[model samples]
Target chain A: MKNIFYITILIFIISSCKKDGAVTNPSSVDQTYTPTPYFIQYPFYWSYYPVPIPTNNPLTVEGIALGRKLFYDPILSQNNTMSCATCHNISFGFTDNGKQFSNGLHGEIGKRNAMPIFNLGWYEKYGEINHRFFWDGGVPDIESQVFGPITNPIEMNENLFNVVSKLKSNPEYPSLFKKAFGKDTITSQLLAFAIAQFERTIISYGSKYDKGILSNFANFTQEEKDGMSIYTDIYKGDCWHCHTISSHFFTDFGFHNNGIQQTFSDSGLARITRDPADMGKFKTPSLRNLVFTAPYMHDGRFKTLEEVVEFYNSQAYLGANKDPFITSDKHEAGLNLSDYEKKSLVTFLKTLSDSSFINNPQFSKQ
Target chain B: MIAIKKSWYILMGFCLVILLYSVSCKKDSTNATPAPNPTPSSQKYSLSINITHFFGDSLFKYNTKFINAANDTIKFNKLAYYFSNLKLTKDDGSVYAPETYFLINFDNSSTAIFQIDNIPQGTYNKFSFFVGVDSLHNHSLAQTGALDPGYGMFWSWNVGYIFNRLKGNFGAANTALTLDVGGDANLMKYDLPTSIVLTSNKVVNLKMDIKEYFQNPYAYSLKTDDSSIHDLSAPGISKLVQNSKDMFSVTSVQ
Candidate 1:
């Protein structure tokens, strides 16, 4: 009887002590686990500026692979019918295939054109300000821009909470997330980080322009040579003002009202900024991949390079917020390029097309 | 042998009683109020702030009708805001700044109360916090916790946090009204006078009067003023932000 009593007392004491110790000891997160880092290779001309990989979310091979899988997965949509690739197809320079505006779920037509995706990592900054994303230049970074399409009512039309839950329940995704983010706990922030990492890798630098620069015009035809001269000539094409080619990315990454419309129907940047002075202003898109990314401008008004060149030649609306470069003393009315000059300019613009980037199997929906 | 056995039984009984008493004491300590006696300054305690919302003199309830200072009948569908960078001023002029960010939504009862732990025992007289995120974190990359974009407080298209959002309907026609106030320039800081004697664990009760947001320094009339305000440069946004700075007040400290 005495032994039984003592044993009971000892067991009670030991259990209580153990419970108290468990409660007091702080729970720890494993901080030693570090994933393998993946470095991006840039063209030699782009070395002047450092790549803006966020310190908190460094790129990894596992992360980029997981991001690629998520980009192609239809589970992110409401009815599991649409994915990022629905609008951003790889064959079309990561843009909707010859469509003016992308079609969303429920056959809803979007108000703006789907911008192409390429060389986004180099768009880290413009002048002193951090680079903005989307046609309106509203979002500050690519990571933040990921949330827009997924939650947009006309786009994916799905809740972020639902997407997280769906990803968590997937058998293959949990392990993939664990390998990339160090834990299986899926979060919207990590989702954005992964997608942004993959987007930063879809670079386009193997075009004829790039090759010609390296070889000092050895590969250029006579027509392409004259086209290049007219493209860079200050008094002729004058396209270098906003669509700067010297930077090699072929864009100044600035917002300007290029006189696309006379009346403020969509109100472009003014819708986000709420300033009338910024009325009708849209982001200056890069001039690369002109062959694949057709139906140009913010609203995708022009269908072909001939139409785009003709619009700039004679149909500039000359609105109040029209960029001074278009209304400058050199060509106040328009570029007024002749038929031969227009055809040559079109041929030269095609030199910016990189077939290797469009056909890269790594960017496909594997 | 009998006497030794009796003494052993007494000692064992005494130890069992001590064990039970100590366990009960540990449980009671968590539920108890602030200790009356002064504790050592080296010891740390947690400070909890319970936020109770109000509309004028009554407790604020969502989807309920209430008359505003403008005499317009209003019914709120949503009310959410962020509290960030909580700082406490000690009696010696020193500041105890806790890196805290909380997204308080009227629909979520769990987010109504937040605790600031690991605070050194001291007499604090002032409390200050920002109604919006700092410019550094606002424009920075993706974030988690309360600042996460998943919370719906963030403006993903514009790349900023909507500091405060009050969506509702008003008037005879039941017109929709959305007031999403956000911007780096409009981050309002409130420095409220407080008398908190923190010897042990303490809970400070704060009352947020929703009616004060429409009145106080600026009298906002839903009938006359622009009912929808999503842009940062909207006409009455500065007035609304100025009015919101005076909404929170410490009702009691325990």
Candidate 2:
């Protein structure tokens, strides 16, 4: 009789416990978590430029924290193996360290070269079409563009619905989502918004280039100074036309054909617009953090800055859709840069690398 | 021998569960179903938008041959676009904005039907909606459903949405034309003025005929003419987009 009674009690106990643990819902009153606004402070020197903070997604402490976690979480990947940081390493100015192409889930290589994410908050509309993010200029906003890699077949290869379902199932993510977005429920919009908020806070103002060139706080070396002259002066390098050194971001943020090919393997902007005239046109990447991010260009063709400079000096093949400004009065293969001039230009590019920005703790994975 | 298996242990387990539940799952305020002054349990308004494709009153069957301005015989692979910020207008001049965004893709039968639920049953006169996302949601990050950039409708480089995308085969094998339109955020928006009386039947069948893209006020004849076919995009784009003004209409009010 005692054993029968015990079995009945055990049955009741297990049955009652099963339903109790299943409730994941947060009631109406607990849904409200106050978001503390985190203001992004800009350097006084860059006041002239517009910060690309979206009016809808202002930065918050909780949001930035959640974004940081998500940015580093491999849970965003299809196989739960790759995170955004897998390619965009914080040590390498948020670019893949010396990788020609980033590795994705199941050993799939990325389609394009990984871009460095720094001072993206200040990247703005330049020239005719105001394009931002990616070499092809496919998506417009940084937040919206976050969908690119996660769903990209060669990248993370995970869908937004799956990402949501996965994040919702995790015990910790729901509360993190609540702290950032004011509810326990998770959504893709909030995921992108939080990640973007964290990315915007990756400010790179403490570079030696900033102090030595822009602020005149540190003295520039003679080689660095001479290189800076070639970089800025229209007669020598003529690079200032596209990558203007006058701006704090050091990029005009315009798309260019850049005299790279004779026959197009990559249609570049043409693929996006379906306009044949846009063949070989690509967004001009920011020249900052060259020390860490190697194998340059949309395809990461050059292994070093010397190779990139040397290619532009003579080996550049201006295809059918080369930009007009890449040539002066006469059509030439390249800039025909003198050997000394090329070295100086390369030296100047190295000064833009910000070690302080890469080492900052706020950007580090905790 | 275990002496009734100590029911107090089960009681202790229950206490521990309650403690953990209190910490993680807040029911004091959050889980409470805000039942203050609950409304009458009336069934909600069932609003559904049905997309019907046509090639000038002839039903648009996919894979059917059609000639383009570029003189190429073409058949559609897919047609997808966004419909955002749909609002039902009442007689009081107020609007009931839906929390949903619709992406109508004819290739997927599921996408062609958009059923909206939990809407308040009322007498709505007219509905206001946009064919593309506005500037606010367009540039914002990681929007789901219709606005998700993963749908291949977003422009990442320039930060805009490709309001409408048309993909199909061209004249010869291996030749194709992808006409992406509607980044002109200033010009792409269209407002529908059709009257929708939502009194007797909560269901409204909104029909979007693809052939209407060719003409309503503007004839997109440039897209069909063979002589103008050499030009890839410039021939009849403006004509087609301008014709978008008459795309959506109230086909049924039941």
Instruction: Please compute DockQ, using alpha carbons, for every candidate against the native two-chain complex.
Output: 0.25, 0.21
Q: Alpha-carbon error at B181 in model 2, in Å?
A: 8.6
Tens digits of per-residue lDDT for model 1, A1-366: 677876776666666566455656667433455678999887888888567887877999989998899999889999999999999988889999989999889889998889999988766666214337888877878788888889888899888889999999998988888899898589998999899988988888889999998998789998899888889887788788888888888888778898888898878787777778889889888999999999899999899999998888888887699889877876676787888888898899999999999998878888
lDDT of 2 by residue, A281-364 (tens): 998888888888887999998999999887766776755778776755543756667788888889888888888888989999
The TM-score of candidate 2 is: 0.69
Which pairs, if any, clash in model 1?
A: none
Candidate 1: stretches off by over 4 Å: A1-31, A127-131, B1-39
Candidate 2, residues B1-254: lDDT per residue as tens digits? 35456676667666765565555444443645676674543435677776666655556666777753334565767677787777888778877887667777777773367677676756677777777777666655466667765566664444567676666665656356566665553335545555665543455666666666655675444335321322223546666677777767767766
Per-chain TM-score of candidate 1, chain B: 0.82
Q: What is the C-alpha RMSD of each candidate to the true structure, in Å?
A: 10.7, 13.0
Scoring only the A-chain of each prediction against the true A-chain gives TM-scores of 0.90, 0.87
Give candidate 2's chain B TM-score: 0.69
The 10 consecutive residues of candidate 1 chain B with the worst lDDT sum are: B24-33
